[model samples]
Target: MSFRNLAAAFALTCVAVPALAQTPAPATTAHSASDMGLKMADTATVKLKFVTVKPADITSSKLIGTNVYNNNKETVGEIEDLVIENGKTVTGVIVSVGGFLGLGERYVVLDPSTISVSNKDNKWAAYVDTDKDTLNKAPTFDYSKKK
Candidate 1:
């Protein structure tokens, strides 16, 4: 064969070999239980149960925005955020205190255990053992600064 023809054949072979060696992906279709020889259980076999909680139980949404009071029955601040540990338990709460209309407000971190909830005058009240003065002086928690 001529050198030019041989080189042309070799280049075509190299390009076509890789394209011919590739296997096409298998086509997929929507499947049902019967398609795999599986049977669906009867509705009667399924049981639905409702989770019950006491009225005093504190939910995450309820905990947030709830007013936090001190031992002196003074409003310290409201809960701005909750710190959950391992997605199961609450470890602490971020309290917004010492600010007017959120201008000078600073967040303070306190343990969830240190707060208590009570039913007073048909309303849920949250109380922290520390006073506003102490909370205002506590170290501020910044959400922007993350570890």
Candidate 2:
């Protein structure tokens, strides 16, 4: 080869060698599954239970904002929310009483047993034994305090 070509090749090899050597290697982690925020469960020891939804079952979606009626079929209050205990049991049902377009509204928590929810012709209805006047006279639920 020519002298000029030989000197150029030598200069290129010297510059490329240092650049290739400076490249970083892939990193390895020593963390386990739990350390990496993954929950590891033993299938042999864990027992999984499943729930079956029947046609007669009433879901929370049908309860919320549903109008509650008295024994006379008069609208007493509207269900605003539900209070569940221990993440499974529903202990109370919050209903809004004496409200007009959501103004001057008062909330009352009633026992789940006092309210009977039924579904007929795809329409859900909630029935209570008390009248509208009695519900308005009942104790009001305060949002600020935890009870």
Candidate 3:
């Protein structure tokens, strides 16, 4: 072949190689059953227990005992009582923050709206929306007639 033709072919091949290099490779398989076997997917099926309740629902519906914890998971308080409106609107929950063996525990009242309800797959946590000063000055409740 002529030198000019050979050189032209080489230049074309070089340009083609770079263009091909700039192209992305085809995608490979991204997921498999084993990779996500234990992960909770949006489409996964779950069986759950159900119940029905009315005004009495507020009393009959089973609720988890409130467990107040310190930053280190130390048990600081337990919900002794909750004050709810007649319509089941929880106004506030009394948290027993401190005491030695249930003796002189100081009850702290927090707004029920601060609590976050959680399930097995999810979690509920309380966010004290009130400022530190407000929470500190919240009225204490009498444990005798609490939640």
Angstrom error of the Cα, residue 142, model 1: value is 0.8
| Stretch of 10 with least lDDT, candidate 2 | 31-40
Per-residue alpha-carbon lDDT of candidate 3 for residues 1-147, written as tens digits (9 for 90 to 100):
543333333333222332323223238735333432122457745333223322222221123244654444445566555554432234566676555787766778777666543333333223333343443466777656421
Off by over 4 Å in 3: 1-64, 70-72, 119-138, 145-147
lDDT of 2 at 113: 85
Number of clashes in model 1? 0
Alpha-carbon local distance difference test for all models:
0.61, 0.64, 0.44
**TM per candidate:** 0.59, 0.63, 0.41
RMSD of each: 25.6, 26.5, 27.5
lDDT of 2 by residue, 43-126 (tens): 443233223344544556677778899989998888877665433345678899997998888999999889888777878889
Model 1 regions lying over 4 Å from their true place: 1-50, 144-147
lDDT of 1 by residue, 37-73 (tens): 1124554332332233444344555555678888888
Task: Pick the TM-score winner.
Answer: 2
Off by over 4 Å in 2: 1-48, 144-147
Q: Who is ahead in lDDT, 2 or 3?
A: 2
Error of 2 at 14 (Å): 73
CA shift of 20, model 2, Å: 65
